[model samples]
Target: MSNDRREPATDADERTMLEGWLDYHRQTLAHKCAGLTDAQLRTASVAPSTLSLMGLVRHMAEVERSWFRRVLVGEDAPPIYYSDADPDGEFRLTEADTWAEAYATWQAEIDTARRHAADLALDDPSTGRHRRTGEVFSLRWILTHMIEEYARHNGHADLLRECLDGATGE
Candidate 1:
């Protein structure tokens, strides 16, 4: 099939535009790991940080699960990649945590997020509480926050990919 990165369409409505950009950022992260081996994906090429391509994949999967399944859909979905004991577990991958599993889980989370967001209104409130303040949020806020989150992490992924092998672009 086609190996093209999807650019967010500018002419769409607010919700559609948000989804498009979010999807674009998601695909952009995957693009950074294109043609790389699992070791390459797991390598913390940028020293002094625990960031890696594989870790990003896993982290974003958890992010998708948290916002869409747990918050937006009101499903009470539990954490997937991290725990209370090790909150950054998603960023720490062992040899056993292969890239295949990371990518598959990330894709599955993305699929689930899309399905959950499909029928929901932007003004809907989430079922989850804020970690620091015990506050609820709207679906609009979740979508906006997710886009910002992906954008930030994708920036890290961009640098990590560059340090690993110089691959770039969304």
Candidate 2:
């Protein structure tokens, strides 16, 4: 996906606006990593920081699964990357982690998330409760939160890509 982000329609309804911006940010992350080799994808931003393009992909996959499948759909979905023993496992790359696998997983999670939210109303409350607050969130809240999550991470991706190859843009 190139950095040709779709401008969210200013006159669109709330749902369309949220989904549009979310997809824009999603594509932004992918565009940042495009044309990079596995080694480049795994290259960390700086010493003592495990953040990398590949790690962001894996982390987003987990985030998608957690919010859409586990929380929205109320599925007993488990973490695909991290665990209780290593809460940041997605960011902690291993020799076994491959770009192909992480990319596929991230795409799959995005697809699943779209499906889960496609038929739900914005005010529909999630079946699952927040892990910390024990409060159920509406679909609207989840969508807004997901947008914020992607936008924040995409900023990091922007800098990482620039550092990696001197490439920079919205």
Best by TM-score: 2
* Superposed Cα deviation of residue 67, candidate 2 (Å): 0.7
Q: Please give me the total number of clashing residue pairs in predicted model 1.
A: 0
Q: Please identify model 2 stretches exceeding 4 Å from their true place.
A: none
lDDT of each: 0.84, 0.92
Query: What alpha-carbon RMSD in Å does predicted model 1 have with respect to the real structure?
Result: 2.0
lDDT of 2 at 82: 90
The TM-scores of all predictions, comma-separated, are 0.91, 0.96
| Model 1 spans > 4 angstroms off | 1-3
Error of 2 at 108 (Å): 0.6
- TM-score attained by model 1: 0.91
Residue 96, model 1, lDDT: 89
lDDT of 2 at 96: 76
